[model samples]
Target: MSKVVLVTGGSSGIGKAIGEFLQNKGFVVYGTSRNPSNYKNSKFPLVALDVTKSNSITQCVEEVLIRTSRIDVLINNAGAGITGPIEEIPEEEIKRNFETNFFGPLNVIKAILPEMRKQGSGIIINITSIAGYMGLPYRGIYSASKGALELITEAYRMELKPFNIDMVNVAPGDFATNIASGRYHAPAKEDSPYHPNYANVLKMMDDHVDDGSDPKQMAQAILRIINTSKPKIHYKVGAFMQKFSIVLKRILPDNIYEKLLMNHYKL
Candidate 1:
């Protein structure tokens, strides 16, 4: 039988690209969107799912299993971003950011792991970000969400090793996508102290995404990862400079790295 693949947030952007790529590779792909009807014309079948809600995740998995009988791979790609100064970002906004980016994936994983454990084999891939390594200016909540997922992925890898399950964290620096249009902007008052720099830095971040590598490249990298019998625990996909930035962080002192980051973002 062909392998079954489940991808969350598969309606558009990187998730959609990965779904299409894997479908073409002959896997039985079931992509999820809160409103599957939105992607009725998509190549792969769309399953209704809202990762933030536990019941929605359970139902989505059940629906997929009814058709495919088994799931061989699960890709946690659903996420959202909140950009603004930390002080200006409301508590609810931070919680919502984590809801979609971190907790959403956790909910899906919990729902799927039972079957994976039953089969004694499966692969789980968490789509993280380069920003996860360190908090980013004007996007602290978004970075924190991804960082939380990264750490969860690390722990799950070790715990699931004996169950014949594999876990991976795919950290993309930036990918040309519609993410900018989807991101939430923290309310900034006219008299807010960080107003001047917040607007410029947020625009800079969006522009960085616009100039990022092709999503198809990220899709291809994911395919390669899926094919590996024993994939690495972590993978970085992006430009040389972006990937090197992570390396620099590891080798540089905190004071120096902080300066480099501030300069690079023009903060």
Candidate 2:
């Protein structure tokens, strides 16, 4: 029997690509979305899942387990984007961002880790973002949420090692996706003072997405990770520039790195 794989946010974008690729590779792939009805003509099964809700997550796992009898890999790919000047971003907006980007994956982990532990083997992949490594100009909240998820992935990797389970964080740079359509824009009003700068930064972000790496490439990277016997704790998927940015952030002087980031976004 092929290994069963469960992926959240699989109705579109990177999640959808991963599901399709895994299914083509002969993995028993089950993909989830908030609305399954619209995920038409899918090659893999589409299940309804709301990762932010504990009951919803639990039920989704149960549904996958009922159909496949086992879930060998669980990929948490559901996330939301937020943009605005940090000082102007509302507290509720920040919380909402964390609810989707950070807590969502953690909730899924809580729901599925027990079963993996019982089986004594499994893999958990949390789809984070390259921005998680450093705070971005207008995407501070989104960055923080992903950064928190990445740290959690690291902690779980150590904690779950003994159980023969692995947890990894895949941090992709900007990817060709519709995530910008649903992104939360904290109140940067026309006369809000930070408008022009924030608007410029938003435009820069949009351009990056327009020129972002292909999601299919990310899917292939994920397949490589899945095929490995002992996958690395962190996977960075994107163009050389994007991957190099992470390395630059680590080795460069703090002020110099911040300057480069600010220049890149024209902040």
Query: Could you estimate the TM-score for every candidate?
Result: 0.98, 0.97
Cα-lDDT of candidate 1: 0.91
Q: What TM-score does candidate 2 get on C-alpha atoms?
A: 0.97
Taking the tens digit of each residue's C-alpha lDDT, what string does model 1 give over 148-185?
99998999899999999999999998898999898999
Task: Give per-residue CA lDDT, model 2, range 100-148, as digits (tens).
Answer: 9988888898889889988889999999999999998888899999999
Runs with alpha carbons beyond 4 Å of true place in candidate 2: none
**Which window of ten consecutive residues has the lowest lDDT sum in model 2?**
186-195
Judged by whole-model lDDT over C-alpha atoms, candidate 2 comes out at: 0.90
Candidate 1 ranges with C-alpha deviation above 4 Å:
none
Colliding residue pairs in candidate 1: none
Cα TM-score of candidate 1: 0.98
